[model samples]
Target chain A: MRIVVLAGGIGGARFLRGLKAAAPDAEITVIGNTGDDIHLFGLKVCPDLDTVMYTLGGGIHEEQGWGRADESFTVKEELAAYGVGPEWFGLGDRDFATHIVRTQMIDAGYPLSAVTEALCARWRPGVRLIPMSDDRVETHVVIDTPEEGRKAVHFQEYWVRLHASVPAQAILPVGAETAKPAPGVLQAIGEADLVLFPPSNPVVSIGTILAVPGIRAAIAEAGVPVVGLSPIIGGAPVRGMADKVLAAVGVESTAAAVAAHYGSGLLDGWLVDTSDAAAVAEVEAAGIRCRAVPLLMTDVEAAAAMAREALELAEEVR
Target chain B: MRIVVLAGGIGGARFLRGLKAAAPDAEITVIGNTGDDIHLFGLKVCPDLDTVMYTLGGGIHEEQGWGRADESFTVKEELAAYGVGPEWFGLGDRDFATHIVRTQMIDAGYPLSAVTEALCARWRPGVRLIPMSDDRVETHVVIDTPEEGRKAVHFQEYWVRLHASVPAQAILPVGAETAKPAPGVLQAIGEADLVLFPPSNPVVSIGTILAVPGIRAAIAEAGVPVVGLSPIIGGAPVRGMADKVLAAVGVESTAAAVAAHYGSGLLDGWLVDTSDAAAVAEVEAAGIRCRAVPLLMTDVEAAAAMAREALELAEEVR
Candidate 1:
């Protein structure tokens, strides 16, 4: 089976690990969200892409579920000592090499897709990992502050620096309207046996990918089973502040609400956690097939079981 | 007294430490060589300027004489793992931070002089450190290999990668002919009570700085005592492979020969190592005042003594 997965950072990476283990024989193509990409210290940093790459390649920090294991902060510390900042973003020495190589290649005129492919050559992520769009598409969050009134900060500053303390009045995927889907993205979706949305932030992660002009239309019309696993469980996010940004987009922090947000037109199957088993009936009533499964990715095995369930649900819908 | 010093990398930096200790209250301005600057991994690596900054700022590796103390190579190792390199140049994690800051500032349209000043704000190396030129002036060594015949490679590749093992047929400071001196370079020379040449490479370091259009003229006509300590002692360089490049410029690697190379018009006094005492009379016969002093910078105290001797010689010439 050929599977296409749209991934964000940690939660998405963890789910993809399960998906890979569950369907070992399947050819997987990951369309990694790049909306969280930020240029720090003049180097391109694709948080979601690197998270998936490192996680699948066995170099991820298992506990944090993002960044490299055994990483040092020498570079970041030195940069801070030089008074260069955004000090809240913990970019480690080992992690910085990725950005350095990426920035160098990009400066040398290679597109981000080509650069991603080159970086993946070292990791051998065992799947075709392509960014959602090579064109710059940064997600900016509009926040109302007493000092500044209103301002749109880079998603990283909003998420990593501010820790999403202030409410997001609006979440904008700036430049997504003009960004073409990166090479191989539409083809992968068209060629896949099924498409899966791992438990990633719907508003800014997978949602930003979908916001790209041609991508959402391609996936909706791809003629393959389109399935999604909820990032919410028991009315709370499985990980990350998914609820905060979901509120910005006016989506309720519930599995059924998230499934309905993706909607029946694009989603054929939806998976809710067993803790929110009642959400399945509401989701199914909204015209998409729904199943309640063990959605907490406590470990790879639990995630693999959830992946298997999603695949089974895809089969049932087909 | 106001003093101006022309400096290169390790040797120049070490000599400056001594000068600082010798004349604790002298207003010193250092015009640092920038021809050795190179772009690595899309970041500007200003070896000489950084050497001076780190050395005087108390952050230098005492044994190595360059780079930051307690440096780590995690970023470099990671870059090599990604197969991105010219790995012979050992840029440690701390050093990479300086380059990143410089490259980011340059990209944001800051001239190298302004960037150097901003970086100095952190290091506070006491003396005002200015680059030889804001415009790019890369030193390229023309070398003949059995495979490539005659080719001009970057000076860093020649010095660091090839170890200057190959004979340099020519040393060209590319882009120096039209390059104007950086802001304050000529002004530093013109306003100085005396100018000193540290035992940096005469061909690539001090020579390249002089190649900037207006700097040599300013120093020669400034009417201040221009005293130089010879890098060459006896018949070889005290440290580094200065002979290989000196020979490329058709100058023999001897204390007396180097003084003649600078000439009486530009140099008023010259200091050779006590071992090269015999060359003092020969240098004096050529119209430049010469002295034999213990020039080995084995320690900061020894370097300070040498600086005192050079300053005393400058007074005698005055």
Candidate 2:
């Protein structure tokens, strides 16, 4: 099977790990969201890309579902010691190496896509990973600060430093309107047997990927079964501050709302947790086929089962 | 009292600590060699400036004479894991932060001099540290590589990676001719009460600083007594491979020859180690006042005593 997966950070990374297990023989191409990429300490840190790479390559922290296992925060601690900070986004020593290498490559004039490929050379994540856009398309969150009122902060500062405590007025993918899809992104979607949108934050993750100028159009025109799993379970995000960003886009923090937000025009099939079974009718009523499954990825096996259901749903749509 | 000292890495940094102790009330301005400055992994690594800062700030690994105390090499280890590196120059996690901050500031359009000052604010290294040149003037050592034949390797790669094993055919301060003195360097030398050259590597360190267009002329014209301590004691360097580079510049590795190399026109006085007492007469014959003192910095007290001797010799010249 040739599958194209649009991924964000932790949730998408974990889901991809399961997808790999569900279809070991499948050729997977991951279109990693780059809106979350931030230049910290002058190094380009692609959180979503790194998370996906690490999780699938067996280097990810199992407990955290992101970053490297046995990682030390020595670099971050030292940076803090120098009074250089944003001390909130915990870049571990091992993780810092990836950024250092990526930044080095980028500084040497390598595109983000080329740099990602070079990085994946070591990880061998078993998937062709391409960024949504090679151009700068930082996700900025508009939030009300006590001093600055409604000011746009980089998505990282909003999520990491503020803990998304304040209400987000809007989520802006700063350069997406003009961003060309990274090399091979459109081709991956065009040739895919199935396209999966894992339980990543729809607004900032998959939504941001879709916001890039050519990417959304390419996926919609790909002529394949497009499936999505709801990040919301029991009317709250299974993990991460997805609801805060969802509200920024004026979307309700529910499985049915999230599926509807993606909509039938793009998504032919949607999967929700058994707990949100009642929302299945509400989602299917919107012209997209919806299935309620045990969507909680409690373990790799559970995640595999969820992937299997999504694949089966794609077959049903076909 | 105002003092200007031209310094390199470990030896010069150690000597500066002693200079600080010897003349506690003196306003010391350091002209650090940027010829030793290298870009590793796309970050500017100012070894000489960092050594002086860390040594004075009490963060230096005393035993090693460079790098941070109690450092971790997690970042280096991880970089190697990614198959990205020379993996020879041991930049610990703590040290990486310094480079990252410096590179970032430089990229933001801050000159190396301003970046050094900003960094020293945190180190509080006491001395007003300035690079010999704000412009890039990397020391390149021409050596015979087995694969590349005659190639100019960076001084750090020559010293750190090759262990200076290959004979240096030439030690070129690559951009010194076109480079101007860093913001405060010439002014510091011109207005100094005393100017001193610590036992730093002459060819790549002090010599490279002198190679910068106006610096050597400034010291020669400065009204204050210009004194130097012999990096070469007896017939070899007290520490470091100064002999390897001295040979490249066609200078003998002897206190008297080194004193003569600086010339009586620039130097008013020179201090040699007691072991090189016989060479004092030869140095004095070249029309520069010479004194023999214990130059091995066995301890801070010993270093302070050496500094005291250099100061007394400067007074004698005055």
Candidate 3:
């Protein structure tokens, strides 16, 4: 089977790890969200893309679920010592190499997709990984603060630096309106037996991917089972501050609300955690097939089991 | 007394340490060579300027004579793992931070001179450091290989990668003819009470500085004593492969021969190592005042003594 997975950072990477293990024979093509990409120290940093790449390539810090294992902060410390900052974003020496290579290639006129391919040649993430759009599409969050009144900050500053402390008044995927889907994105969606949205932040991760002009339309019409696993369980996010951004978009922090947010038009199947088993009927009533399964990716096996459940649900919807 | 020094990499940096110790109260301005600067991994790597800064700022590796003390090569090793290279040049993690800051500032439309000043704000290397030119002036060595016939390679590739093993048919400071001296370079030379040449490479280091359109004229017409310590100790360079490049310019690698190469019009006094005492008269015959001194900069104290001798010779010429 050919499976197309739309991924964000840690949570998505963990789910994809399970998906790969569950469907070992399937060809996987990952459309990584690049909205979280930021230029730090004049180098391009694609947090989501690198997270997926490192996780799959065995370079990831397993406990943190993002960044390289055994990484050193010498470069970051030196940069800080030089008074060059955004010191909160921890870019390790090993991680800076990825950004440097990516920035160099991008500055040399290679599109981000081509650069991603070249970088993946080293990682060999098993799946063909492509950025959602080669064109720049940064996710910015509008926050109200007493000092600044209200302002739009880069997603990284809002997430990494601010720790999502301040309330997000609005979440904007800047430049998404004009960005064309990267070369393989639409084709992968068209060719896939089923499309899966791993438990990633709907507002800024998968949501930003869908915001690109042609991508949502292509997936909606791909004629394949479009399955989604909820990032929310019970009434809270399983990981990350998904609820904060969810509030910015006015979506309730609940599995059924998230399923309804993706809506029946684009989603054919939705998986909620067993903790939110009560929400399955409400999701099914909204015309999308719904199933409650153990959604926590506690380990590789747990993630693989969730992946199997999603695939089984896709089959049931088909 | 106000002093101006033309400097290169390791040799120049070491000599400056001695100069600083010798002339503790003398207002010293250093016009650093920038032709050796190269873009490595898409970041500006100013070898000579950085060497001067790191050496004086107490960040330089004592044994290696360049780069930061206690440096790690994690960034470099990671870059190599990604197969991104020209790995012969050792850019440690700490060193990469400097390049990143410089490249960012340059990209943001800051001239190299301004960037150098901002960086110096952190290093605070005591002396006012200026590049010979803000405009790019790469030293390219024309070398013949059995495979490629003849090609002009970057100085770094020639010196670091090829180890100057190949004979240089020509040494060209590629952009010097069109390049104007950087701000304060000519002014510093014109305002100086005396100018000193450190035991740096005559061909690529001091030669490249003189190649900047107005700098040589400024020094010559400034009417201050221009004294130089010969890099060639006996019949060879005290350190580094200065002979290979000196030959490219048709200057023999000898203390007396190098003094004649500069000529009396530009040089007022010359200091050769005591071992080359016999050649002092020949240098004097070229109409420049010449002296034989213990020119080996084996330690800071020895370099300081050589600086004192050079200053005393400058007073005699005055």
Candidate 4:
């Protein structure tokens, strides 16, 4: 199968790794969301692309879920000695080099998609990793908090800084309306035999990618089976604050509701945790092939199984 | 007194600390060369400015002469994992935060001068540390070598990368003529009662600052003495490679030659090492007051003595 996976950062990276293991023959092309790319300490950091690349490339920090292993910080101390600090986000000294190179290359007139490709060349993250767009598309969250009232915060600030405590009234992917899909993104969708949305965040994860101008339209027009493994396992996010974002988008924090939200127009197949098996009939009633295989993805083996099951469901729908 | 100082990195930072110790009441302004500033790991780093800031603010890595003590490198490891590196320049983990804040501030439409001022608010480096100019003016050295014939290299690549072994033919602070002095730089020179050239590289340090528009003229027309402490001690630089740069600027690396290179119109006074007393007479013949004193500033006490002696020479010239 020529698989095209739309991914966010950590969760999607981890899932892609399993998907690769599950179908070694299946050619995979990952279209990563670039809206979260931030310039910090003069380095251009694409959190999602890095997470996916590292997880697949075998350089990811096992414990941290982000950045690299065996990093140093001599440069960082020198920078701090210069009294340059925000001191909030955890950017390792070694990690800064990646962002630095990315920023430098971009500043030297290369688009971020090309930079990501160049960066991925060294990592050799088996499958092709493409950014959603070269243009800036930052994810901004609107929050009503006591201190700032109704204020917009960058996705990192909302997630890393605020720890997502404040009620997210709305999650807007800024510049998505204007962002063109990166080269080969639409082509991959058009060429795909099957597209699988991993058990990732519905709103900020898959939803953000769909928000990009031509992406959702391309997927809708692709004329292939699109399957998704639900992130809501047993009525809660398998990882991260996927439910928090769901609330922001006014989607009920449930497996069947989320699958139905993707609907028959986009999704031909929907997956659920075994615990949510009771909702399978209801989801199937919505004119989609519904499956109730375990979707927790506790380890790589389990994740591969999930991917395989999703693919199987895609076949069933086709 | 409205005192101005021309300085380089660590050695200069330490001397400035002692200068503050000796002349606490003097309205001291530092004209710091930005030649050593490099873009590493995506962060814009001003090494000399950092050195001055850290040394003055008590955050300096006293043993290493650069970076901060007790630093980390979590981010750097992450970066390397992404396979990004120059790897030679030390970038600490804790230090990355500083660069993040600095880059963020710069991206937010703040000029480097104002950003530096804001950073110094926290570091509180007592002497005003102003960049020679807001515009980039990197020093390049033309070197004649066995392998490359005559090739121009960045000051850092010459000094740090190549170790200054290659005989330098010419030194030029690129873009300096077109580069304007940073706001308040000329004003500081114009208002100075005494301008002291610290024991720093005459070509790359003090010379680069002088290369800026309106700086040298302002110092000359300041209506006060311009006194300089000799970097050349006992016919050699106290530290670093003043001789290599001297070769580039067509000046012999001697107290007398350095004195004559500055000339009478710009310099009112010059201090040399006691061992170079004979050269002091030659300096005096150039119509500039010359003092032979112990110019080896090993510690703050020794540097304070040098500062006191420089101020006294300014007094004598006045």
Q: Choose the strongest candidate by lDDT.
A: 3
| Candidate 2, CAPRI quality class derived from DockQ | high
Candidate 3: which stretches are off by over 4 Å? none
Q: With candidate 2 superimposed using the best TM-score fit, by how many Å does residue A92's alpha carbon deviate from the native? A: 1.0
**Model 4 alpha-carbon miss at residue B301, Å:** 1.2
The positional error of residue B232 in candidate 3, measured at the CA in angstroms, is 0.5
What ranking emerges by lDDT with the best candidate at the front? 3, 1, 2, 4
Per-residue lDDT of A1-318 in model 2, one digit per residue for the tens? 999999999999889989999999999999999998999999999999999999988899999887889989887887787799888888999999999999999989999999999999999999999999899999999988789778999999999898899999999999999999999998888899989999999999999999998778788888899999999999999998999999989999999999989988899999999999999999999999999999899999999999999999999997
Name the top DockQ candidate. Answer: 1
**Candidate 4, residues A241-314: lDDT per residue as tens digits?**
87888899889889998998788899889988899999899998998788899876678998898888877888
- 10 residues in a row with least lDDT, candidate 3 chain B: B182-191
**Per-candidate alpha-carbon RMSD to the true structure:** 0.8, 1.3, 0.7, 2.9
lDDT of 1 by residue, B198-309 (tens): 9999989999999999898999999999999999887989888999999899999999999999999999999999999999899999999999999999999999999999
Give me the overall lDDT of model 1: 0.94
Q: Which ranges of candidate 1 are over 4 A from the true structure? A: none
Encode model 1's per-residue lDDT on A1-318: one tens digit a residue: 999999999988899889889999999999999999999989999999999999999999999988999999998998899899979999999999999999999999999999999999999988999999999999999999899899999999999888888899999999999999999999999999999999999989999999998889889998889999999999999888989999998999999999999999999999999899988889989999998888889999998998999999999988
lDDT of 3 by residue, B149-188 (tens): 9999999999999999999999999999999999988888
Candidate 2, residues B33-129: lDDT per residue as tens digits? Answer: 8898888999999999999999999999999999999999999988998898878889999999999999999999999999999999899999899
- Candidate 1's displacement at residue A212, Å, is 0.6
For model 4, what is the error of residue B236's alpha carbon versus the real structure, in angstroms, after optimal superposition?
Answer: 1.7
Which 10-residue span in candidate 1 chain B carries the lowest summed lDDT? Answer: B231-240
- The residue ranges of model 2 lying beyond 4 angstroms of the native Cα positions read none
